[model samples]
Target: MRREAVLKQSGCRHYRSQPTHGIGRYKHLLPPEPDPKKKDKLPRKEIKPSSDHEYGVLNLQVSGYNMILVEHYSQYVHNLCSRLSIKVQECYAKPTKTKEVMLMQEHSTKMFLDAMLTTHERVVQVTGLSSTMAPILMEVLMMNQPEGVQLLVKEHTEADYQVRFKGRPELENLVASMS
Candidate 1:
């Protein structure tokens, strides 16, 4: 028996007819629609808002064992130094992120501080501190840090309140006094 005749006898019209590519009437099969809500949602893996901590700088003037706390995470430290166009003599990394890096400059504290204050307006804007407060903070640090004191920073925020003096027994005694 012929295949077409057999198919026709079985009541199967599709197999009985010749197959056509695109010229015949075809049954359309549409894909399922996507969920609208899922498409509108934001991704969950973005950086968290609370994670503000970042790499920070520590400005110091260390002469021998004596270290001076110049400035903390404030822009005064970074911007002022950059404006003064002073090159860093050395950089020492801190043991922890919360700790400070030791920075040594070639010039004296008075000269360095002058450059820092000269750019006071810019420094205040960059560090998010008032112009008046910047000078006062510098004054405090200069008066507090003694010979053989090691300057340390507390992290991303510049020198301000987060600055400290380490090294030297006398400085240690002074640090104890500050507390």
Candidate 2:
């Protein structure tokens, strides 16, 4: 009785009737159709290297559980590049990452933190490296790599720069709107 009274006051005619099967019954609640004449935005293009070398810029990322070992190895790589006459653009330390290991107790429903491992990372940027010299550098670095240390070498792109920083979409939108 109260529902019908409220519905009648709100000017609803089909308060107790079954819903219709046709799409027109809910057309007012559906989103408006997009304009077919409007053109969609295209993705931004990435900058390409101009040189003929395999990679215009190479990043040697070294990471390890031991901070001292990771730092020393990165320094060694920088020195080795200088000895090989490769231009070392920059050497910088990346932020340290920590991971927690959790273990479940026997016959228990709770989990506890067993250990925490912290990893340190460093990157050595080398520019103007030739295809022939890259292999030699990799071979030497791998042979001398310390225990528990990981090394990765790849071409540096704009994505690498973006990954180093945190994303702030609101700030980006504000800047775009201001421009």
Candidate 3:
């Protein structure tokens, strides 16, 4: 009975007034007007890592001496990229005349090279060649070595700390020994 009396005395139902749009308030509720300039804006160019640049044949005449030029390039990369790790992923696969074979080999070599470079947590692909195009290849790779480089030397195996960068020659030797 007390609850019923309190409810009767209280007049709270339907007391709130409907909201009206104030000055400039209606614009907030409407869809945004399209900008003609923004609709025609040019697409932004993608900034990929320097190592991710397309592999190109580079011919550099670094004072006509290839090895010296390569050493200089290597030193430059090492000095410049103090923060990033630098490594050389030397690829020594035999050359194939066939386009398909060459492309596939190049692709595979690059993938392996990338993996080896990544092991050091570096950021460049240093593809080297000791062929007629050696100088050119060195130049190209050096150009791409902004952050650092993985020197992928082709057709040369010198045993110091390593034979090849990924040590394919060493692996071959082990396999042959096992056989």
Off by over 4 Å in 1: 1-126, 150-179
Question: What is the descending lDDT order?
Answer: 2, 1, 3
lDDT digits (tens) for residues 38-103 of candidate 1: 756423322212223321222343222211222232323454444544333223323121223344
| Tens-digit lDDT string for candidate 2 (1-179) | 99779877867555345555343578568999999999676444344463766568778999999999999999999999999999998787877889999999889999999999998999998888888888898999999999999999888887776566556999999999999
For candidate 1, give the lDDT of residue 59: 36
Evaluate model 1: give its TM-score: 0.19
> What order do you get sorting by TM-score, best first?
2, 1, 3
TM-score of 2: 0.64
- Candidate 1 residue 73 Cα shift, in angstroms, is 14
Per-residue CA lDDT of model 3 for 43-138, tens digit only, reads 432222222333232212111123344446555544433323222332122211121222235435552222211122221223322244445545
* TM-score for each of the candidates: 0.19, 0.64, 0.18
Off by over 4 Å in 2: 1-54, 166-179
Q: What Cα-based lDDT does every candidate model obtain?
A: 0.37, 0.84, 0.37
